[model samples]
Target: MFLHSRHLSRRVAIASATALLTGGAAAGAAWATTAAAAPAGPRTCTVSDLYVSMGRKEGAAGSLYWPIRFTNTGTTGCALRGYPGVSVLDAAQHRMGAAATRTGGAVSTVTLAPAHSASAVIRTTNGPVGGPCQATGTYLRVYPPASRTAVLVPAGWKVCSGTFRVAPVTR
Candidate 1:
């Protein structure tokens, strides 16, 4: 009876140790997965870190579309979310009209590494709806997402429509 009891105790001890080891391994695996899935926080792209430019222009149905590109010029990775503030500027650097309206789009965070770029689509009507264009614009003033400073991009053609719409920044 004594020998039998000892064998039973040994079996229970082995089982307990096995369970503990299995549970620890599972916990460790869960922690590893969570750590791997966690995203690294990136800084917001500042006006100095970004270079704004216009891409090829396209027109359809009396509306013009231009791709506004923001290139990350800094050495570190940065993020841009939502739409950029856009406005037409005359040669004297005065705002020609109200800021561009934000069009509906999926506003997701875009991480840009050094030298990488993201683009937003700007749509403007061919002409003013109510009256003739107030003034010819020589440049397009662009403000980075969540930034107050503006970047001036040369406009090859004058913008007739005072109102414009801008899509969200995308990869």
Candidate 2:
């Protein structure tokens, strides 16, 4: 038996679309591992377990808010001096702002309990165009220095980045 030409073309198109969808789903899952629940900040040492969530505030133009959580995954305690700041870039990767604040405040130290998580907020004064980040990348600096100097949260520590998305709030 022979199949019609139209049917054969349709089958090929469906297969290609399916493969693209599958690849996209896998990429999303891999990125999720980059951010995870953590155990606060370590004391007396430098350990990092930081997670950052990005979103836009209502009526806040050119601004992005970062709900940041820094935790200690190690056995010892560590001191977290500064939170990773926000960097907004345009389509051409031009630096719009650097090290933007997640929230307005002065945080010197935060001690994390074993197997616990500490949370903070960091925001940008000069923001991304259209009230949403053109591109959002978070950075964390380890105090007392750590085995690794700094971690760009989006690059994915073990796997792909957690979730770098535009969470728009409607009404």
Candidate 3:
């Protein structure tokens, strides 16, 4: 017996559809596997992996700027994105005033290799700017982004509540 032309065309159509579906599924699986096997970027930098320090003081227009440096002391590379938490502390290890607010800047992920460094700028005034000096700071407490732990860098400044601002970390 011989098949009709209509029946033969329908069979071919079905076979073609099946082949396309199978090939598409296999291609999708292969793509997924390749993507999964790709290596990931560096992890976020933690306080334990960094050595924080205060850079030289700079002043302009009655505002004080300090470049807070974060050096990667770990064995591997890490990343630091966004702003670092900054606050003034008195001699007794107590918070002197309100925490430093985040200032405007181009925020991007800063990848630091081992022994490399990233920095952020903390701005305040020597005496007072927008408000009265709330307390005198003997040490500046710094918290790296996304980290709960904080490190203290020796600093002598008059701190005003809601007056301190910090820029984002950069290379």
Candidate 4:
């Protein structure tokens, strides 16, 4: 009789442990599903949400390279994908040269938290490569991708090549 009681007690303990473990596992799975169902990431960056600027100037082999930067000024996180529209503008806001041609390259989405930035490479000839270059541009009009608004950055440089090439935006 004592042996029977001991065996029965052991079976009860095992059953209780199994039930607790199964309940805990089910609770954990429910929590995981709830967490995964949360909302998606923030929206794409607009021109108003970004503060545009020209980064450091670099020269190599008679070409000038500048990083066109877009900094997120808003409090929320945002994404920038693809190329930005670039054009040199005269003092009267007229287009000085043709719009910058897209420099073919791998483009990936860049996500920026508040105060973060992304950049694109801008290339131009170091000097007049062709003949009869005229009209100095006083500003660079930058249009962020998918945005209707544009930002003007002071250029204060002569565009001797009358052409600009811009690489895709990247982190």
Candidate 5:
């Protein structure tokens, strides 16, 4: 979903504050759990310029072949996490992340370079939602690292995001 620049700013404010409030002490918990279960990533660095590409329809409901592109654009590689987040803003649907409900979308393992990019597809459907999916704009905002704690959202420090559109798979 395309968020207006102003609205995006507000979303940032809400999301940041929420993260801060929830993550303050939780950050330590996450570290404790992750330290033993995982190894250090590509490196220790700040994440920035997170964004998603325009979404594609994937032929709608029952038969979906929709594609979404992703890129890191961060100073260092970051985990794409469990599933590529599929954010849907439907007055009728009323869902947060459509992919959360749908089972086909999968986030691939690829390291996004400063400008490098990749595309992935929802190969099959488990519980696909039908849509007259009228995408207003092609892009979704990126949620910055849950661990980025700061008194202020700094300059040149952009939260990640992507547009919503359909296209051939790119890498």
Candidate 6:
């Protein structure tokens, strides 16, 4: 799926990333209990209900793994299942390469309470996987499962191949 930018400000990006890393402490207990035992949530999470952010990059097997977090910012719990639609975007807010392909993982619904989060890992190559390099990505456009709306998260990468893959969303 192609994601179109909404031209959000830098302040919004910082705030969203902050929420992913530090703002969900109080809700951890609820998140743990529900995510482990609860059934699928009553409603699916929408883009407006999530604050998306990218965690620190880790390198392995000649590829960089980015942990993309989706924190629930709404008042109620919502569900996230399967893989998120991910694509690299340039500074000009245009698609930089092919969208991510689902790699592997058990598909399970994660019910996130307000302030809690679920995550997916995106794997990108440091060297060309399929062809020569193109423009480096400045941001990622991520669509939560089952939603058309896209959330933009700041990123810096030059992915040359269509080999970019994303693991399924998990608790």
Which number leads on TM-score? 3
Ranking according to TM-score, highest score first: 3, 4, 6, 1, 2, 5
Per-residue lDDT value at 132 in model 5 = 38
lDDT of model 5 at residue 28? 57
Q: What local lDDT does model 3 show for residue 1?
A: 12
Q: Which is superior by TM-score, 4 or 6? A: 4
Runs in model 6 lying further than 4 Å from the true structure: 1-40
lDDT of 1: 0.82
| Best lDDT among the predictions, by candidate number | 3
- lDDT against the true structure, each candidate: 0.82, 0.40, 0.83, 0.81, 0.40, 0.81
lDDT against true structure, model 4: 0.81
Candidate 1 structure quality by residue, lDDT tens digits, 34-101: 45544558989999999999999998888879999999999999999998998888888888878789
* Clashing residue pairs found in predicted model 1: none
The TM-scores, one per candidate, come to 0.71, 0.38, 0.78, 0.73, 0.36, 0.72
Q: What is the Cα-based TM-score of model 5?
A: 0.36
lDDT of 4 by residue, 1-171 (tens): 579657656665565566588875455544444455455567889987999999998889978888899999999999998988989899898888688899868888899999999999888788888744557678989999777789999976455566578899988
Going through the candidates in the order shown, the clash numbers are 0, 16, 0, 0, 27, 0
Clashing pairs in 6: none
Candidate 1 segments whose C-alpha is farther than 4 A from its true place: 1-40, 128-131, 156-162
lDDT of 6 at 146: 91
lDDT of 5 by residue, 57-76 (tens): 44544444544555566765
Residues 34-133, candidate 6: write the lDDT tens digits.
3454443469999989999988889888787888999999999999988999999988889976898999868999999999999999987867866666
Error of 2 at 75 (Å): 1.5
Query: Which 10-residue span in candidate 3 carries the lowest summed lDDT?
Result: 29-38
